[model samples]
Target: MRSIKPTHLRRRAFPRYLSTTTSAQPHIVPITSLLIANRGEIALRIHKTAERLGIKTTTLYTDPDASSQHASCSPHSVGLGAADGYLDGERIVKLAKQHGIQALHPGYGFLSENSAFAKRCEQEGVVFIGPPAQAMADMGDKARSKEIMTEAGVPCVPGYHGGEQGEAELLEHAKLIQFPVLLKSVRGGGGKGMRIVMEEGEFLQQLKSARAEARASFGEGGEVMLVEKYIVRPRHVEVQVFADKHGNCVALGERDCSVQRRHQKILEESPAPDLDNVTRLELWEKARTAALAVGYVGAGTVEFIFDKDTGDFYFMEMNTRLQVEHPVSEMVTGTDLVEWQFRVAAGERLPLTQKEIIERIQERGAAIEARIYAENPERGFLPDSGKLVHLRTPRVSEDIRIDAGFVEGDTVTEAYDGMIAKLIVRGQDRETAIRRMELALRDYEVVGLSTNIEFLKRLCRSPAFIAGDVETGFIEKWKEELFDPVVVNPEVFVQAALGVFTSHITKDAEPHGESLGFGTNSSERRFLFKSLDVLDPKGGEEVEVSITQKGNNLFDARILRKDEKAQVFENLVSSSAFAAGKTGLTTFFPHTRIETTVIEDPNNDNKLTVFQTGAKTELSLISPAWYERALGLKELRASVAAPMPCKILKNEVKEGDRVTKGAPLVVIESMKMETVIRSPQDGVIKKLAHKEGDKCKAGTILVVFEEEEGAATAR
Candidate 1:
């Protein structure tokens, strides 16, 4: 194979990043043109590496991602023209051949781990930048993978890997394994198609639900599940392994992804905190053994469930592609894994042997990656989608990396994953890393949709986490502190009052007032302040305030509250970063100047969000609570609504049906994950607005409860 370095490749520094490089090998056919068969941040991430390596690339985008940044990053492009186009491997492979692209890089997710897709790429003579098709097929099946790992002398979770999946037979297996067993689908990944059966009575019900979700997510093949002994306190540790065709494989290092939500990792760090060097080396050896067992090649991750109590670890699963949290490993190791993938795919030998791979490590440091998602962490991490509207990211430097697929104004549709970006920070040690992460989260901002930024900030400062005590149940264990109600400062109320006001103060300030200006001395502006996570304003945590603006927009602000001293803020110097751009609103108060962005709610003129630093406080103009209650404002709080745009998988309740609090009323599927919407209280269903198979947007009422007679009589 003759090597060819095309001229279309431009040598550009990867935006404050430079990947490790290697000399050209004579036995390699340099892939001058590549096609990225993925979308979102991963796609953009790949494109960056490809460009840095002087390789021309092509990217694919679906209809929803047509306007996405990743779609336009590549000089060459293709449109899938459908929402689920990323999963259409056949079409992707054909497009690669049609575009004369020499290699196709499946940057995780979608068809990245699909063995059939890898085989198709091989058949088309297009280099697939991943493990061999056989490796993927061998490790793709969770049960089979366990069997192979056991044969390879790798410790695996003790469980039933047999074909008898009937509830009765599974129950027998569970009995042997004891209570609190894990029911995992053979085809499960990313927390789908799995459930925890804590006791015998709930075994069958959990099994049924798991099977249903598995069937929906992975088709009929997902119906087959294996039972395993559940680890009460487990730390999710995974090793990054790379292999080449010449029978060489090496472990980059291990990462602790114990902090997760819904079994999906949210925070990941390298050199897993508090791990002993001896066990760490063993982990790497075991990971390599597992990789070599399947004749693996390219980038792969060997996940293990580390028993915190016993110090024993078992193989959990193998992800046969680059991972989302790969950046942390890169930051700590100072070796570009993506560049290695490209090199290995081009038939080059491993850049460094096992000894060199270990020796090449720079000075010791720690790196952590925080995943920012368009989800409300307070509300069970429900998915949220909308236009980015406003986005301000932390500065990207040598130690700080922001990998995102969307910019301001781009929309986060419900057709795909809700992850917005990844904030990766590196420091001299774990303590430094945690501190930097907290500060980074403080500088990051996002509006127009709820995000997990605030939740992550709390986790960064969490005592348990700071002390290096991490487990899969960390979030739930620190639930109260992590979800503590945010106290809105009284000064923020002044900011809110100055941030937005009406035109008429005394039945009129002047019929013609500056649209952006505040009200007068008697403005009597009434606004309620609440954190974005508070789903309903009726929550007792919310604060109601009345502000009377005497001067310009926040020029002179006086705040008064019950039992609180009246504070006056004068000389409210203000400036905007961009002319008429929603990006900036800097206001200087008496004590300090705060960066604030006030975004008027598109759906409601009376509602607005004031973004301070990175925290966002939502304020809405409303009548007094008593008056609104008397007039029946916004519907009663006796309804069940879809947390996100989703397809109703099953309606478990009907009109006139009575349900107890927490009883399942409906199951809705969003992006292939199913969530059961339960009754908020014990009441009879007054109406069934949506049934099975209906698609509804977020906040769409699915069921309304009949008003209670006692409450009604009081009204």
Candidate 2:
């Protein structure tokens, strides 16, 4: 990997299409070369669109990412050090100058929302392919943005957006609106810097915390505004709107981003399910009006919170840049938003009108997108770090599109966002699109790192999800039912065990030897069995696992005790020999061989090697399996543990506390969200794990209880 600077790889700006036969005015500038100031899928997405328009693309990469898919795609790519400040305006300006880059595209994150950065680009004689800094500044202010939305006839959520209001005033407003109001920062858009207070007593406390978080997340935490009406089952629906310098604005369509965790969307799809035609028209019309009112240009999203109970919606906020889930909108609209951004910046009129866009949506409709992230949902959805040992993505046809950042062996660090790829699938109808996406996800496998692929599969097939009854609380409500991994079908366990065993023998057996053991009339064969303890990350409870294997393709396992012990739940295993001969069977047992298929090399993010002969003790392979089995333990224990390491904010239990099963015992704070640890069984508190200020991790033993004399103890 040579060290190439952004200047050397800068794409030249293409002149506008010469004298279009149409009467539409010429674009502002012929966008020739564009420097994408971000990395990964977004950078690649921008590069592809820019290239298609005859525009050259400039991309920068950290040393480790020099060989990324996006980097290789660009005609010219520069390698920059991660510590060299890719997000810094000075560094970007320097690159632009060196590359002779005419414009800068701040993909989606990092410097995308930085008004000063955009202003710097303007001052440095570089075009920032986004909205004017002033527009971003105005909309960036929560109070001012709300004022604009309210003035424009968009139903803004009622609450305090006023500049200054005391805690008492906010409390009074809360009281008037009733409890369960949303305490939000004026500049808050994402789930961050926001809190949902269910009671009046928690108002001031939550307000302070929200303000502190806001100040940390966005400089100058503005007045803490209150939105009186908070929808419990709210759907996040946003309209993608694009405007040009000529004042021509159009709304592409709506995307249902209701599938979210901690206020951040995970899975997003276009053509919101069950959205009434009347509401759809109204939403598009309102989105167009909002964009026009703000003088917004380029690609932006007008977000709204839709309530299923009342069929009413309120404008949430306007994202003044490309959204993370724009692919879904693009698939349905048949419009390339990135290309439009270039043309709009080039001073071209919006290629389509609002009416025309509506007609087009009616014709070409239905698409869905799922964000594939290198995250572990079973572990409180924490970000994961590792290399892409073996990356295999499904091929994209007309209906499937995959936008990824890294390639095989690429490292996914915690320093950046968890997203690895965007899986977008399109169909004439929603069912076809979803089914196609499921197939793609199954085929798409990344072995080395932990991801939410399994979770996404479950979400897509969820009855509630299929019915479009999705809300922000969907994950919470159905998590228990959706995440019971303990009860895997007997056949899967048998296959997995055999795979493991076969892998072990292949590695240890002599090159010419027929069998290590388990041959004709063979018994008492000596084999090392490394027992793994699989514990839940959130709760430190461990499940008992029993694995027994005979020959290559035969195995059986049992759960000694489930966390939530029910009637003796049992499992059986079955397998068929693959080699089909005595010599082959003795040499390489099919089950053990397949069970131990090395999807990835645990250490090298780049290399994926399987166990062949010299069997060595490795923890990585078995540990994840252990954890996955722990994850399978669906039933909650009679005891409660901390979901994550967090300070015990408040305790609802005391020594000798008589509580029923499911009773809330303590409220633990982690990453700002307060999760209440509930009692799994009706029992008296025999012991307390921590005090109010004591911190504990997920699986931390928080409390214990003494069982009845005749009751069987957890074995």
Candidate 3:
């Protein structure tokens, strides 16, 4: 096996391809140029397929994403400022018309599912690279789509899809459906405006909460709510369907997206594991029927909720556009869905029949994709945004691939989703696919902000996940193993000490950029660092790492932790830090050495983020008389702080309101999700820093609690 090298990550520029072969059949109005009306990884995904097909492409980017690779890598691009925005279909269509673009591809978010936007594109003589407006309109509403599915002979979950959505009317239906009912908005997707009521007593509160969120997310279209029986112990499976101008529709394959957090998928794999041939055939038949009934002409996904124990399934909803996990299906089927979209919109026939697609899928192997997001899984999966100081991803090969829109030094703003990239791998079978995914995740590294990489690694290693036993509640079921308690490993301190020692030694040593400098230490070097972060910086357990110079780049290093054994390690090579790069180092521990990256926070030298085996560990370098350090450490136990940068939607409490533990204090909306800030304990509100509609950064105090009898409360 070849050792991988880390570098600044970026997608290479693609040239316009020219094919030599001629078409065998005639096609009308072939798309010569296209405008991608989206941003981030999805935009780049479309661009790559278009480039390979010899089609000209244009992309749009807002001010916040000026440096994004998706916008810069395009052959042609138009920059939209903060005011213009990606949601303005009129502006995008006008730009398309002005540039002589033949078609416009709305890549999955923003305006992809907007039926009105698709109609606008048609009226302006620009082909919309998606299904017809009628198809999107019918399936965009959950209630109406359920009725259509039932009429088309597709099995749907039992629900009340009537026009009457009054609070009293819905409450009566909840009783008819029994306890543990689901409240969903008429126009809902992406888990917004949806809530689960576990009992009859909690129906009304959950309804009101769901309604408020629905209205906020979908406007007037979300005013109506529907009631249905919530499926317990269910697995999420969706089938990929494609159609053309001809009267032929086929199911490409199926993917399992059961592993999720907060109702969004994090891991997905093709050829859903542990299912017999009979179930797969049934799954495909229903998915094809649902798409054909609505005249779906382009790419679409029909989602289903499958009973884990019975193999019975029911239609959940249908996505009118491409899904984020489409890559896995493509990997198994040997298809380029974006290219198919271009051909279908240009009045072409289906490339293959149903039997041909299924045969191809069977011949190919299994594939899995893991979504890499800029969020902290340990902190309730809160979205995080900041500049990526350092970023490295696994190299793409025959078995591994990476799709991304950001590179090193790019800023991840709160104006859009926090996805960094998608890591995909393929193998001969299910077990091989899982093993490949695990190794790929262990090779990915990131810095400057929190991410879910470590959590993803743990998920790939879980026994249940390995055995293909997974469902929607997999994370909650395996939380104990996924979120293991942080134990500062002794290897981390040794790696950090060597990195620090070599970083100063190599200030002018550029000859051995791949190895630590072979320079002699002028004097004894010592560093003061803390093993873990505490409320008081001065009153913390300090770790002492001492270095005594022996010769050129050779030294004796000792680590002394509070109330622990004193351990010592010496250099195996001339330099204590053996294999070293500008941002990485390998420290020898008597018998073995491991690669570690030492990154000093650009803003503060006292803050260090050490990467060991692709997992990040944070330690603070203690500087004496650090008045500034004390000021930055907030009283986390006495105040409720914002989890991330977001706008306050509402304040649920007054300045002097008394609240019990778990009481809602504030409601905030960020990254298209609503979260309620709750009281950590019983206390009275002493102050509120920001009011409703105010924008605040992460760690900004939203509510401060008064000390009651010397006991503190916070969130």
- Give TM per candidate: 0.89, 0.73, 0.89
Model 3 per-residue lDDT tens digits across residues 1-715: 0111112223343211111122454366888798999999999999999988888999999998888888887878899889238988889999999999989999988889999999999999999999999999999888889889888888888778788878889989988988788888878877788898899888898888888888877777686888988888889999998877766688888999999987788999999998766677677778888988897888999999887765568998999999888889888888888888888888887777777776787788899999999998877888999888878788798778898988888988888878889988889898898898988887877877878888888898899999999999899999888877566677777667667667756665322111223345354566666754322334345677776667665667778887889987766342434232335765556777677777767766666778786567778766554423434443334888898999998899999999998899999988767889888788888898998899999878899888666445343
Flag regions of model 1 displaced more than 4 Å: 1-26, 360-364, 502-555, 560-590, 623-627, 630-637, 709-715
Task: Give candidate 3's TM-score.
Answer: 0.89
Better of 1 and 2 by lDDT: 1
Model 3 segments more than 4 A misplaced: 1-27, 504-522, 531-542, 572-582, 625-637, 707-715
After TM-score superposition, the amount by which residue 704's alpha carbon in candidate 3 deviates from its true location, in angstroms, is 2.0
* Residue range 414-470, candidate 2, lDDT tens digits: 455668989898987888888887777776656566678778888878888888888
lDDT score of residue 653 within candidate 3: 96
Question: Ten-residue segment with the worst summed lDDT in candidate 3?
Answer: 1-10
